[model samples]
Target: MGHLSTHVLDTTAGRPAAGVAIELRRLGADGSSEPVASTVTNADGRTDGPLLEGASLQAGTYELLFHVGAYFARTGAGPEQPFLDVVPVRFGVTDPAARYHVPLVVTPWSYSTYRGS
Candidate 1:
């Protein structure tokens, strides 16, 4: 079945953005968001386990919300007025048998993401 995972890297610090909060959400039929799961990045800037694993995954739209602002502030990498705040990356999952890896590379001012293996 489909699985979801993510990793975070702090481009500004040139390291992992550890202890960052992340939320996984599924889009509801009525066009609203529903929480599927929530997790915080580990010291390696990765989820302790799959965000959504085994039969929990379904083919649909999903969103990963990263709390970059708070992470940067807490880590003393940037001030409250950092360039980037909350960053939301959304993508569609079409294959239930596939593994989906969404990796985020971010700094206080910018970020990037791509479908990873």
Candidate 2:
């Protein structure tokens, strides 16, 4: 079975970004979006379970909206006006049978992500 997972790491603090809000959305062909899942990161900065798995996982474009601004505000880790607000990591899922691990390594000024095993 395939699955989709994510985690947030605060590069500034050098720790997992716990309590970050994440929204998973499936992109439509016409540019519309459909909400797939929404959850907050646990203490380990990971979802309790795969956001999407098994039959729900599909081959298409998806977006993970990481609410970094709110997270920063709550943690008092970022500036009053954040340079990087709600960070959106958008990518394609080509194989439904493969595991998709998209992680966000972020700071108040920047963020990075990649396909992981």
Candidate 3:
């Protein structure tokens, strides 16, 4: 079975980005997106469970939207006029039987993500 999971790291704080809001969405052929799951990061910067697992894993394009603005504000690091607010990560899942660990390394001004182990 395949699985989908994620984690967030706050570059500014140099720690796991706890309490960051994240959303997983499936992209349709007509440029529409459907929300699949939504969750907040834990103390370890990970979701409580795999966002999509077992039979729910599908081969297609997906997007992960991170509420960077809210997260920075909660951490008392938000700027008066934020440069980077919501961060969107879009990628494709080609093999449903594989594990996908999408990780976001972020700060109040910027962010980066990659498919991890």
Candidate 4:
């Protein structure tokens, strides 16, 4: 069955972005969304388990919210007012049995994401 996972890398520090807050939400067709999961990255910059898996994962649109500002604040990095705060990555799941790994490579000033293994 399909499952979802994520990782965060602190490009500025050249290491995993530990302690970053993350939220997963399933988006509805009516511009509404419901929370699916919430977690913080561990030292390895990954969630302890797949965010969504098996029967719980369906073919649909979803959003992953990364709290970059809070992470920088807690780590004592970045400017007082970070240019990039909460980064929202929205994507669609086309196959129910495929694994989706969305990883974030970020700094206080910028961020990027792509579909990974």
Using Cα atoms with residue i matched to residue i, what is each candidate's TM-score against the true structure? 0.94, 0.98, 0.96, 0.98
Report per-prediction Cα RMSD to one decimal.
1.1, 0.6, 0.8, 0.6
lDDT (CA) per prediction = 0.91, 0.95, 0.92, 0.95
- Model 3 weakest 10-residue run by lDDT: 75-84
- Clash-forming residue pairs, model 2: none
Ranking of models by lDDT: 4, 2, 3, 1
Q: Write candidate 2's Cα lDDT for 1-117 as tens digits.
A: 999999999989999999999999999999999999999999999999999999899999999999999999888989998778899999999999999999999999899999988
Deviation (Å) of 55 in candidate 2: 0.5
Clash-forming residue pairs, model 4: none
Per-residue lDDT value at 84 in model 1: 79
**Tens-digit lDDT track for model 3 on 1-117?**
899999999989999989989999999999999999999999999999999998898999999998889888877887977777889999999999999999999988878888999
Q: Per-residue alpha-carbon lDDT of model 4 for 55-84, expressed as tens digits? A: 999999999999999999888888998888
* RMSD from true fold, candidate 1: 1.1
- What is the C-alpha lDDT profile of model 1 across 24-89, one tens digit per residue? 999976899999999999999999999997788888899999999999999888876877788999
